[model samples]
Target: MELTYLQTFREIVKWGSYTRAAEQLGYAQSSVTTQIQRLEASYGAVLFERYGRTMRLTMAGEALLPYASEMLRLHAESKEVVSKQSAGALTIGTIETLAAFFLPPYLQAYRRDYPEMKVNLQPGNEPFIIEAVKEGTMDVGLILDPPLADPELHTVVVRKEELVIAAHPDHRLGGLAAAQVRDLAGESLILTEEGCTYRAMLLRALKEEGVEHQLSYEFGNLEAIKQCVVYGLGVALLPRIVVEEELRNGRLKAVPFSHPSCEFYTQLIYSRKKWMSAAFRDFIALMRGGRGEASKMHE
Candidate 1:
């Protein structure tokens, strides 16, 4: 069957009227009717049933809807893939933290390695980045651990990041050399939005231990949260890498939790069904190099 006829059928089903579909497609209403007629004739069944001025799908059309939608989607994706390849673009998605601190030098090296390849980076939280990869919105993802039940997605733990509790230099908690997870009770705590994977894990730990604390402030922006902690508003639990500068400059004090240090796993995830392009492979290789190979490298 011709692809254009299937497209015409989709437009008619979407708009519910042949005239409206034709108007949207910039074709005559009679042309839309002819296409539907040709499609029905080829299948030997009526695809639509007239109801007043509108049309509804028949059993045959209903059965074919999913396949037709998938075919149209694949066709659109094919065009996109071709366009990206011709333009030498490689799209990578990750969270704001990594995109800000970790990925810059690596991306620069990637460009140095492949000057012809254009790199496109999209930054979001873990869930958003994972969904982008799954939906083919991104070609590759460097995300924090995504809780995916599907076995088709490959997740490789590139490194372990310690979740550190930080506070202002003169805060009461700063006097304690170390803190147990239970010691945070009755204190003001700053946190990220609930969609953050780390925030979810921290909240789960709090619930499990029944530790009660006042949530003084919450920010979707990590940098803003760090600034709040630095300014002595409240303590916050964040990945060590995120606040390394603050710690080094004595602007923030990191309180270690000994009993059960909340360690988060950072990963490079990509779709199993996706064919990794050459540019993507190069970028991944740069990330997985020896501990001291790159300036941002850490054990």
Candidate 2:
């Protein structure tokens, strides 16, 4: 009956664990359990069932999911309609690379425009961000990926982000006019963890070209991957924006490489069903204006 209980249920589904959801919501595990129990009582249906070590949504839970999302969305809409507030919270789901290197200046300018607005930059992989946008959870999502069209969401290509293969200054492949897939054969590669969009692109391209390379290291953190490349552990595929400073400082070299499959973009996505806020439109406008130039940045 309580909206907060529904919120908890959604959080549980998002996190896939009672304890994890509780931590995310800043509630005790017992409190989360009690809230879920109350939610179940109101519906008179078991929401979750244990499948081995994981808790999975039961048939009833699957049925309630959409209604719960719609109710929460409407609740948010009601507040927006009634208050007509000049400033409020805006959550943007994005990936770590964009959060670290790409979004700060745009966000800073946005803050200057809406100083009272609370901007929550939620970081996740591309797929998770897309799903969160569709679910009405994130106000908008910025993802580095190939251009994709979804009926449930409005997609905008903010910029075509160039992916590059980074190597140390002393590496054998350095100073070449350009590197091709053929050049990658037998080379040791330091890769991002499995889900990275560019990483997948690179692996797929290599597989198609029959290029065999060593997977020397797999790091989730971009900085770690850069550091390893700097030490000559191996070359890595990453966005050009991320390694700009290193390349300028003579630490890393961008192997001249560009392939059709590896081309990704900084894309903006928002649900077609959700009402767009003024702040949301302004943020997208700023992104389209230009990426804050690196030389102008103080950070």
Instruction: Give Cα-based local distance difference scores for all models.
Output: 0.77, 0.86
Q: Whose TM-score is greatest here?
A: 2
lDDT of candidate 2 over 2-102, digit per residue (tens):
99999999998887899889999999999999999999999999999877766789999999999999999989877866765557788899998999999
Error of 1 at 10 (Å): 14
lDDT of 1 at 119: 79
- Model 2 regions more than 4 Å off: 52-54, 290-299
- Please write out the lDDT profile of model 1 over residues 55-171, one tens digit for every residue: 999999998776776676577557646765433667788887788877788888877877877778887888788876775557778876533345646665667666678899998
Cα RMSD, each candidate:
7.5, 4.4
RMSD of 1: 7.5
